[model samples]
Target chain A: MKSLARRLVLAVPLLWLLAFFVAPFAIVLKLSLSRAAMARPPYEPVFNLSDGFWGLVESARQFTFDSYSLLLSDWLYLDVYVSSLRIAGLATLIALLIGYPLALAMSRAPAHWRPILIVLAIAPFWTSFLVRVYAWIVILKDEGLLNHALLGMGLIAEPLRIFATEGAVLIGLVYAYLPFTVLPIFNALDKQDSALVEAAMDLGATKTSAFWSVTFPLSLPGLYAGALLMFIPAMGEFVIPDLLGGSNDLMIGRLLWAEFFSNRDWPMASAAAIVLLGLLLAPLLLFERAQSREADT
Target chain B: MPRIGASGFAALLLGFAFLYAPIGLLAIYSFNASKLVTVWGGFSTKWYWALLDNRLLLESLWVSLRVAFASASIATVLGSLAALVLARHGRFRGRTLFGAMIYAPLVMPEIVLGIALLLLFVALGLERGLLSIIIAHATLGMCFVAVLVHVRVKMLDRSLEDAAHDLGAGPFTVFFTITLPLIAPALLAGFLLAFTISLDDFVLASFLSGPGSTTLPMRVYAQVRLGVTPEVNAVSTLLLAFVGLVLLTGAAIAQRMRAV
Candidate 1:
């Protein structure tokens, strides 16, 4: 009975994930190898269980690499992939720069104030993400507040064309992801022994040198965690780019969206998704390792 | 703790300003009388009033709310169970795989999950609608719930549970009597987090929602795509307010529980 209860406990959530999470990936992989068709589901090689075992074998034989080959051959796909990487990379770096200082300050805050500071740091994240991104639209437009402020200050003669540009997308990505980076970094920095920094300073290292040699090095784990958190999702970010980016320079996320929704090409979208997942595998693995290490320590 | 230097303090202020300015601007502008989002007009509640009468927006909001509540409830249950598996069930078979599956969704791109689930539904001949969306969201949210609840579970005093068992309490009885109340705050936090995630989601809803199932985010995205409008601003402001209230309450509860 005890063994049965243990099995029951594990089986419930595990079965749910297997059915909903893992099974979907298997379906996507199979779909990516199938052809696009004008059917209700819009993909070929559909296995009809009613047709029995022979039909299943026949359908399996119909799988093709056409979708993947198309993706590889097209310069559009290649360009979007590269640009997505570049944009996600640049955004992660920018977020790190902005997040690091804030996290450091937050960690250095009075003990009584740390919880409030932490809440403040993460408060924006709990708000509607779309609303926050939409806020940028109102600010970055030609007749927007940002231009108005700049124009009022005589900073620029004309309204800067920031909206629907790569710059705007970068801003949105960094803004949306900043909290993710900050929390991990703050946790890392806050948990470290302050005595080490004091020891470095007592040994005659200047504050800046001591920070670089001791504090920063100690925060590497957090840095990696934060970067992975930011980079992985930013790479596949659709809403930010679709809303803020130019029509011509599509990210892979936007491209995949168009493939599935606008073009109704399930196979193509699945192929793009497969590639995107492949790209994220290394970082995801690193994150898992980092998480387990953190758990251990 | 070390003192935050002047420059670090300045950076903190600026960073927060950057983080908050957009949403703050949206809330402030929601009352702008003029349709032009940037232009300052006399303050009015016209947009808020307009939101009340807009049937499409109202319908979507209802759909979103129902979806959020249902999915969050389901996620909370499954996720709590998963948390127990991770924190209480020591070194179960396939534990590494279980851990990976739970964490993967947290970091995986939304678009990937959206499309993957969409395809799965299509393959299984399931209609895309509220039911589909709830399942997709629950799948996504359960991981977050598990992660959140796992923290509280790890911090639990095992001796209390052992004592309950020693005094002739069954596993279920001990779980219900001792463990459930102890982890209630984290469970509440997880539920709220899941609900917020479902409410704020667009990508999954976009792919999974069929006719008459448009979510508020989907509606807002469609509008925002066209251009900015005061009505969208009004809806966004309301959402921001609702989410902020929920989170602040959650934070307060968490803090209170920690103090105990």
Candidate 2:
């Protein structure tokens, strides 16, 4: 009875994941190989099983790589992919630059206040994400508070055009994902023993050298984790770019939305999504491998 | 730890300012009497009153709350079960695949997950509505719950469960009377985390929701795209307060659990 109960417990979640998680990817893959049409459902069904088992085999022959081919042939899709990577990459780098120091400071804070500092860092994340992005629109608009402050300080004679630009999108990305970047790095930094750094300093290493040699290397795992956390979502970000970015800043997320909704090309959109998944797979696998390694140790 | 250098202190100050300034500005402006978001007029509570009368916005908020509550509850159950299998049922078959399947949603792009699930629903002839949104939210949220519960499960002392088993208590009885109680805090944390994720979700809800079933984020997105208004600031401030309350309660519970 106990063994049966154990098997039942295992079976339920396994089946749930298989049906909900794994099967959907199969649908996406199948859809990517089908052709887009103007009819309902938009894409040609992959198989018609009603004609019997032989008919299923015959229907399989109808599958086409036309969507994939179109994606390959069009420089527009390729450019969107590249630009999305560039924007997300730049945002991740900037986040790392900003977040690393803040996390280091938090780690170096008085021990009694560490939890409060951590909570303060994470407080902003609890609010609605859309509201957070909307807050950016309020701050970056031409007649926005930023320009008002700059003008009042005589930093600029006129309001600078900061909104509806790639820079604004980058700012939004960094702001949205900053907590994600900081927490992991902070976790990594917090776990490191102070004794190691003190020992290095005792060996005649300066503070800066000690940090570089001892503290920084130990925090690499956190850095890597934070980078992946920020980079992955930043790549396929829809809301930030959609609201803050101008028409000129065409990331893959926007491109996919346009293809699926505007152009009504489900196959093309599925293909694009597949490619986006492919682009993200390497870093994701690396992260998973690192996590499993951590588990093993 | 070494004393933080001046530069480190400056960085923390600047970093925190960057994080909180926008949110602070939104909250402050929600009470603005003026129409424009930038031109801060004297304080007024009129937008809050206006929000009470906005039927569409109210309905969407209702939808969001219902979805969050339902999905979070369901995700907690399924996720805790999965975490239990992963933690206690050692070296199960297809364990690696199980781990990957559970964790994939955590890192998967929302757009990809949104579209993939949408496609799956359409293929299955399911109507897009609250039901679809709930299912999608549950699938996404369960992964988060799993991660949280899995960590807590790993940290649990095995001796108590072993002793219960040695006393001839059945596995089911041991799980119910001992294991469940010990992990209740994790279960609560997981539920709240999942609830927050579901409440804050926009992309998946937008993709899966039908014409009449817009969520709070989708409504806020539409309004914000049209133009910024103090009304949005009002709604956002209220949402912020709600989420802040939930998070504070979760933290307090966690702290008390630790104290015990």
Candidate 3:
């Protein structure tokens, strides 16, 4: 009876994940191999169980890799993938540059004030993400706050156009994801013993040198975690680019959305999504490995 | 500890300013009397009043609240159960696979998850609506709850449970009388986090929702794309105020519980 109870506890959530989580990916895979059509449901069915086992064998034989081949042969698709990676990578780098010092400062704050600093860091996150991105539009548009302020200060005669550009998208991405970068790095830096840094200084290393040699290396795991957190979502970001990017900006997420919603090409969109997931799988697996290793230690 | 250098202090100030300035601008503009969001005609409460009469926006807000509540509650139960299994059942078969499944959704791009679930709904002949949105959000939210609850469960002292077990208590009884009380705060935190994520989600909710089930984020996104208006500013300000209140209340409750 005890064993049965234990089994039941495990089975319930495992089955829930299988039904909702794992099965969806399988469906995406199957849909990606099918042919697009104009009919309702929009893709040729991948399996036909009506004719029994032989029917299944026959259907399996009819699966095509044409969609994937199209992705390779078309330069636009490849370009879109590369551009997505570049934008996401740049945004992650910028976020790290801005986030690291702030996190380091927060970690080194006086003990009594640390919680308040952490709360302030996280408070902005509770606001709606769309609203935050919208806030940027208010500030960056042609007649916006930044331009108005610059004109008033005689910084520039012309209204500097920053909206609907790659720069705008970068700012939106960095602003939206900054907290994700800060929290992990703070966790890592905060947990480190201050004695290690003191010891390095005791050995006659300057503050900067001790930080580089002792503190920075120890905080690598947090940096990596923060980068991955920022990069993965930024790669597949649709809202940021759609709202902030120019009409020609063709990131994979926007391309996928266009293919699915506007063109109504389920097979093509699924193919692109599968490829995007494949590109992300490496870093994700590395993250999972690191996490389990941490747990073990 | 060493005091922060002047440069370090400046960096911290700049970072906080960068984070808070845009949000502050939004809040300030919400009260502007001008229809043009950027122009400051004067302060007024007209936009707040306008939000009350906007039927579509109000309806979408109601739908988002329902979905957030339903998904967060369900995710909490499933996630807490998964946490228990991971914490107590040390060497179970398929444990690694289970752990992987729980954590995978955390890093999976929302766009991919959105598309994958949309396809799943279509394949199953399920109509896309509130039910579909709830299912998708719950699946996504549960991973976060699992991560949060798992840490709390691991940090719990095992001796208390062992003592209860030795004193004529069954597993279920010990779980209810001891374990449940101990992990309640973590559970509440997990639920609030899940609710916030679900409420704020636009991508997943957009893909899964059909016809009348549009969420507030979806509505806000559609409007924001066309142009910014003071009405959006007012709605956003109200949302910010609501979320801030909930967060403060949650923190206060947690502090009081800890003190006791």
Which candidate number would show the highest lDDT if scored against the true structure? 1
lDDT of 2 at A180: 94
Q: Give the whole-model CA lDDT for all candidates, comma-separated.
A: 0.92, 0.89, 0.90
If both were scored by DockQ, which would come out higher, candidate 1 or candidate 2? 1
lDDT (10s digit) by residue, model 2, range B124-200: 88899998899899998888898889999999999999999999999889999989888988999899989998998
Q: How well is each residue in A181-291 modelled by candidate 2, as lDDT tens digits?
A: 999899989988889988998999998899899999999988998998899999989989999999889998998899888998998889999999999999898887776
Ranking by DockQ: 1, 2, 3
| Minimal lDDT window, size 10, model 1 chain A | A1-10
Report the TM-score of candidate 3, chain A only: 0.95
Misplaced by over 4 Å in model 1 are B251-260
Clashes of each: 0, 0, 0
Docking class of 2: medium
- Model 1 DockQ vs. reference: 0.79
TM-score (all chains, Cα) for each model? 0.97, 0.97, 0.97
Candidate 1 structure quality by residue, lDDT tens digits, A240-264: 9999888976899999999988999
Per-residue alpha-carbon lDDT of model 3 for A1-297, expressed as tens digits?
788888888888888899888999998898889899879889886565678998888877767899999998899899999899999999999999999999998988778878999988988877778888989999999988899889999999999889999999999999999999999899989999999999999999999999999999999988998898889889889989999999877799999999999999999999999998898988787776766765675
DockQ of every candidate structure: 0.79, 0.75, 0.75
* Clash pairs (backbone) in predicted model 1: none
> Would you list the rank order by lDDT, best first?
1, 3, 2
Candidate 3: list runs displaced more than 4 Å: none
